[model samples]
Every structure is written in C-alpha cells, then in structure tokens.
Target: MTARVLLLGGTGDALAIARTLGPQHVYSLAGLGRVPADLACVVRVGGFGGAEGLARFLADEAVSLVFDATHPYAARISANAARACLAAQVPYWALRRAPWRAQAGDDWRMVSGWAGVVEAIAPFARPLFTLGREPLEHLNEVPEQQHWTVRCLEAHPGHARARIIDARGPFTAEGERALFTESRIDVVVSKNSGGAATEAKLAVARGMGLPVVMMQRPPLPDAQREFTSAQEVIGALDDYIKRSSNA
Candidate 1:
C-alpha cells in the first residue's frame, strides 16, 4: 500500500501543500480560520487532544509520514507533532518559514510576551496591533490614554479604547500605508510571521518611521526532516509515497 500522509496545517504554506495531496492523505487544521472545501485530501478540523492522542491517531490511520506546516508561532502544535511522530515511529517533516529580518530603516523592538508588549507600547498613543486575537483578550486592560487598532482573522465589537479590523492578508504596501495614516498609528505590534501576505505592514512601518513591537518566536521541537518551502515538502512527499508503494 502507498504511504498515508498526515499534514498538520494552519498557514498559507500548509494550504498550498494540501492542494497537492490525494484523498488517502489527511490535512489537519486547528479550525481557527476558514476551512477549505476544495482540497482533494481528507480535511480534519479541530485538535487531536495532544501528543498522546496524535500518536494513537497515526497508528489507527496507519499514517506512514507526517508533515507539519503550521504557523511559525504555533510552537505547541509543532512540539506535539514531533513527539507524536516519534512515539508512532513515523517520519516527521516540518515547513518552517524564514522570519522577517529588520531592514536598515526599520525600528523593531523584540518582546517576549504580553507584558513586554505593554511596556514597549507605553510611549505610543496610537498603536496598531497585528498580533491576532490575543489583543482582544486584553481589551479591558487597555490604558486610558492610548487607543489600539487590532487586526485579526475575525472581527469583534471592540472596546471603547480599541478598534478591531477583521481581514485576511496578501496585503499590499499601499493599503498598509493608508491604514497607518488613517489610524495615526505611532507604533506597530506584530509577530515575525514571514511571508509576502502580511509583509506589507513592515514596509509601511519602515516608510512611516514607525517602531514595531515584535513578538519573539517560541522555541519549537526539531522535526526528523525540516524544509523551509512548500515545494520542498511536496517533492519529498511525492518521493516518499512512491518509495512506500514500491516497497
């Protein structure tokens, strides 16, 4: 039988690879955003409990290989995948996108957590937060003097001190410039999620000479095989499936 593959995915790169998979392969998601209805592969939404549960799933499904293409910040899921694959004795591969590096004109401040973000943004009155829904949880804690503009996958009725924008990316530099100008964003709060889709904000920040409070990436477990690009994962998966079938 050909090797059955399990792809743990939530990012754009993961979705790209999922399009190449067949019905025998499984594409797993955390169900945070819109689930694709068009993929040829089996789409499994929600979680698998944890590493232990994932190991059982691998064994039950007889998955020969697993690919992890989750967001760069999704360290927990990646760690679970590594542990589960190890326990099941299945090949584990990860697609880790390269992070955005600071340009010459960019003023970037790295923060480890929410507290650090609060501290870093203390000096700015109008801050644009692109760090997702985490900021929504802290809306009650917003300072009386400052106003926050938050962007995430889903929009919510924002607090008096906060304004929320719900949108997806592949954003352009022109749009980002307009947003910054209209909001009077003095500083930007974001994660270093590298890719073209959301990168326009960084360039706009650079052009506007705005400081960015960047969240540091959490440490993730090392996979058996790690690739940086979607094409690399697809090529390897095809080769692995062929080898498994021939065996």
Candidate 2:
C-alpha cells in the first residue's frame, strides 16, 4: 500500500511543497479564504470537526505523514493537527516561516495579543490594520474616532469605522509606501505573519518613521519535526517517502 501524506494548506509554502510532492498527497484547506489557490494535488476544503475527526480522517486515508503549513496565527488548527497526528501514530512536521525581527529605524511596539494592539493604537487615530478579518471583531471595543484602514482577502462587514481594502498580499515596498502616504496612516497594526508576501508594509512604515504595533506569533504545538523553508520541508518529506517505500 502507498503511504499517503496529508498537507494542512493555506500558506504559499504549503502550495510549493504540494507541487513538489505531486498528486499523491492530500491538501486540506480551512475554507476561510474567499478564493483559495488552485493546486496540483487533491484538495479537501473545511475543517475535520476537530482533533478526533482529523485523527479519523488520517486513519481512514492511511496517511503516513502530516505536514502543517498553515498560517502562523492558525493556532487551534495547528494544535489539532499535532494532536491528531500523534493519536494516529503518524509523523507530523510544521513548516513555519521565520518571524520578522525589528531593524534600525523601525519604531515597533511588540505586543503579546489582540488587547495589546488595542492599547498600543489607542493614541493613533488613523491606523492601518493588516491583521486580517476574523480578529477585526476585537476592535469593536475601540472608540469610533480611531478609524481603521484594513487590508484583507475578503470584505468584512463588521467595522463601521474601517475602510476595507479587499486585496491579497505579496505587496511591494513602493506600493505600501504609496498606500501609507495616500491614506495618511499614522500607525500600522499587524500580526507577525512572516514572509516577503506581506512584510513590505513594515519596511515602508519604518521608512516613514511610523509606529507599528506588531503582534507576536502564538506558540506552535510541539511537533516531531519543524522546518523553516519549503526546500527543507520537501527534502524531509522525500526522505520520509523513500523510507516508507523501503519499509
């Protein structure tokens, strides 16, 4: 029997790894995005109920290896993946992109969670929020005077004081600079979703001497293996496949 692999999709690294692994693998998406990227592998959308459901799916599919390449903020899913994989006695690995470090000229106030972001941005009226749609609900507590310029993949209906820029990322520094200037944004609020895709805004903010309230990444569930790059993940998965074949 062929040893099947399951990839927790959503990030660019997930797509790249799936492309390398070919059609034998299963790519699972959370169905959060309005339009998910089309991939080469067989794609499964939505949740697996929870940890037990995921374990059942892994067992039913005979998945030998699990690769979690979901977004950094996807803490619950990641934890579930880790638990499910362990329960099913399958190898689990997480491909986490490196966190962004502060550089010279970067005025950053690193925060632990969403509440910290509210406190940090309380003084600023014009704040550009790049933390995505789900977390925007937390901002309802903030006063209406703090108008937000939110960038997200899908349009969120909740924020009355927010001007939603319905767009995806991998944005350029020049483009971000123009946006901050045009919006007259006084502060930038973002989660530490590391990678070149959405980091240009940070560079632009630094250049403009703007203060950024950067949310730290939540702690990941302990995995048997953890990789930082697509290449590393690909190599590891390849080795696992080869070993399984020999076994």
Best by lDDT: 1
Best prediction by TM-score: 1
Summing lDDT over every window of 10 consecutive residues in candidate 2, give the lowest-scoring window.
32-41
Query: What value of lDDT does candidate 1 attain over all alpha carbons?
Result: 0.93
- For all predicted structures, in order, the TM-scores are 0.98, 0.93
Clashing pairs in 1: none
**Residue 53 lDDT in model 1?**
97
Please list the residue runs of candidate 1 whose C-alpha ends up more than 4 Å from where it truly belongs after superposition.
none
* Per-candidate local distance difference test: 0.93, 0.85
Give lDDT tens digits, candidate 2, residues 150-189. Answer: 8887766746776778788779988898899888999999
Could you give candidate 1's per-residue lDDT for residues 185-219 as a string of tens digits?
99999999998899999999998899999999999
Regions of candidate 2 where Cα sits further than 4 Å from its true position: 34-38, 138-142, 157-160
